[model samples]
Target chain A: MYGKGLRALTLATLVALTATFALVVFWAPNDADQGFIQKIFYVHVPVAIVTLVAYVVGGIFAFKQLRTDDRKWDVRSYVVIHIALIFNVVGLLTGAIWAKASWGHWWVWDEPTLVSFLIVFLLYATYQPLRFSIEDPERQARYASVFAVIAGAFVPLNFMAVRMASSLVHPRTFATAEGGLPGEMMFVFLVSLVAMSLLFWLLVKYEITQKNVTWQIRALRRRLLGDDAVAPIGRSAAPTIAPEAAKPLGQRPRVSYENSPEARSRGPEEIAT
Target chain B: MRSREPRPMRPTWVLLRKDLLLERRAPESVPAMVLFSITTFVLFHFGLGRDEVEGSLAAGVLLVTILFAAILGINRLFVSEQAEGGFDAVLLAPIDRTALFLSKAMALFLFLTLVELVAVPAFAILLLGPSPWDALGGLVVVLALVNGALALVGALVSALAIRTRSRDLIVPMIGLPLLVPALIAASRSCAPLLAEGGASWPAAKWLAVLALYDLVFGLLAYAVFDFLLED
Candidate 1:
């Protein structure tokens, strides 16, 4: 079931992204002024938008983790944050390149383009240490989840605060010729938005797959080696294997931890399977 | 059989009294705040040079100095609590979570305001010259609003800092940017007041913005305090 869903998502993303790129390059009208360089906007703006969406999705998953106490949501939140960081980095690079071409400077400190990206980068960068610092899984998830919500709230507020600063550093809003945009450019922009969202979804799915596989391998190892070798997983543990699978080749699986020296020292309660 | 019940308001008062009594005995926070404000004023007076008119700049300088000092004090407020392991006790108290937040914020606000009352007059006499009583009123309003906003936001950041490796660094990282609007509003409002002039539209607008900020973040801090205080 999961394999089929993955395949369908992959096919849809490939087709959508190809169409979007083609439309951006050929069909959309060039700036009556910026010429070829304006093409960067199609990529830069959509990616920035999707990056914000990814962070918000991460925040939502974080909230879910707190409410449901589910390890799955914690993993999902981590994957979304990872994808958001990647997209944010790409957005920053594309923005800097675009700024150099148009503004005649390699970096503009006051530009909303530069400042907002910096804030988002700093916010996500703090999440990793926050996750690792706590020893317990449930505690780590809870604290990180709260931090995510607070950081998510600050994102829009920071953008607004910077916008209100009394300086003519960056333009308030994007300008397209003819007041808004020509119809073709609008179509291209929408297509690009959809394409980027799909790409992010696929990336998140891949990362989550890798994470769950690693988790399952660890659990399997613990099962085979007996409870003595592996410390008990906390409240965030993956579900136990079904009873039919517990027999392990009809040899009466040696799950006992009583005889192991390490388990004996720690006490029986710590080793019970 | 009688059922045991929680004391509703007493825990909050106990926490508030504990902070106040500590201030009365040691008096470290208020004195340090005053000394810091004075030193900051002197530095700015010398740094900006006498050619710079002290009137408008004086208000901004005072506001910035007071906030910087208050941040120092607020950062230290939790230190003693943590050292004595009193924070967990407070968390384990029977009071509503919001009351704990409010009590801490209120105590800090009162202490900072007392320091400001002394510093503002000394600032006006030495640097900006004497002003009309109306300026004092405006200054009071500005300081109250600004200090409340700071305390509200600072409480949450302080809570976050406790869990982090670098508690000191994280407080400012989360705070300075958030404080910008309040800083601007306080400075603008006080500038006109120092001249004994009526509040201008721009000053009023800035004050309105400050009020809006306080309302939004005050509610936010209340809502999130539980999450932050969670074990």
Candidate 2:
């Protein structure tokens, strides 16, 4: 089911991204103020917007995970954050490139939006280490959910604060607020937004598909060669599924701590009850 | 069990009292935090090569110093819970888990206050070019709000990182960036107050930002703290 609509989504994203690139280079008019340097906005702004929105959506998924105690949501949330982190890197790189082109410098803290993005990227960069550090699968999922929820809430507040601080010193150039983009530019921007969003959805879907397959393959290997043939997955930052989820009904799923820290600290009696 | 439970504030008080008593008995976090701040101020003196700093320089130095100092306390915030049986005891108790969070934040606030009591005047003596006393009232308000932010954020980050192996590394990496908005609001609010032209009241809007940050993160830490304690 994870890969069900992946093909269609991938196709749609490909078309949209190609169309976007074509329009940006050949169709859209140059900005009166920024000239050709504004071309980067077509990709940079959309990627940034999609990255931020995807991160929030990841939080929402984390919330769902916490509410329902569903590891599926955790997997989904992890992928969303993973892919969004990549897009965020793209957003920052392209933004820097655009800044270098528009202004003389590579980084301009005066650009509050870019500054906020940097802060946000730095924050989310810790998510992996946070996840990787905790070895217990259940505890890892739960703690990661909590972090996603809190950091998700941080995005908008951070933007507002940094923006307020910067606006005092410089005029708002990136303020795509009212009367910002003209007609054709807005159209192109909308197209690019759609493209980036589709790309994000496609990436998340593909990641989930990969995860499900890996779990299923692990299950298959254990089934064919017996549990001893398969090694316990050592410490990993990636989310792992219940062994049973990877197998069909009526098959018994083995539960072993193997060399886990949880096994060492917890007495067998403590673990049983 | 819920009916027999002590009221929320009661446990909060007990926990706070326990932390204060522990600090008084052992003196682990606060003394280190104060020493850390004063040491950082000296480092800043040599690092920046300025005998005296004013305006933005003063604001930057003060905020950065207090921030790193707060990191020390945050790094050690949950050691007792993790090392001892405190986490299990609290989970076993009928009292809400949020009491732990509320009390820890309160304890952190008190420790920060203690640190500032000595560190702020020490900052005034060593590095501050402008007279800190000139803006004493405004500085107090800004520092209080900043303390609120640090307390909430520190408690939350401590919980998040407590179970991790790389805790010492995780504390500052997670806590400082998470503190940017509050940092922005605090630094901006303090820059004018610390100006040599004489201390002036900061823009209320910046204060509002700090308050909002504390309120939002306070509620957020409350909501999410339970998951960290789940067995």
lDDT of 2 by residue, A106-151 (tens): 9999887689999999999999999999888998899989989998
What is the lDDT, from 0 to 100, of the residue B149 in candidate 1? 84
lDDT of 2 by residue, B1-231 (tens): 357754549989998999999999999999999999999999999999999998888999999899999999999988998999899999998898999999999999999999999999999999888887789999999999999999999999999999998999888988988999999999999999999879888999999999999999988998899888989
What TM-score, over all chains together, does every model reach? 0.78, 0.92
lDDT of 1 by residue, A3-103 (tens): 22667788999999999888888888887767888888888889999988788788888788767665567777777887888899999999998889888
lDDT of each residue in B1-231, candidate 1, tens digit only = 866686676667878888899899988888898988888888887887752344567677778888788778767767777788776887786667776777788888888888987887777666775454556667777788988988887776677666656667766665665566567667767777765334332356767877887887787676667766676
lDDT value for candidate 1? 0.71
- Model 2 achieves a DockQ score of 0.82
- Worst 10-residue stretch by lDDT in candidate 2 chain B? B1-10
Q: Each candidate: what lDDT?
A: 0.71, 0.87
The DockQ-derived docking category for candidate 1 is acceptable
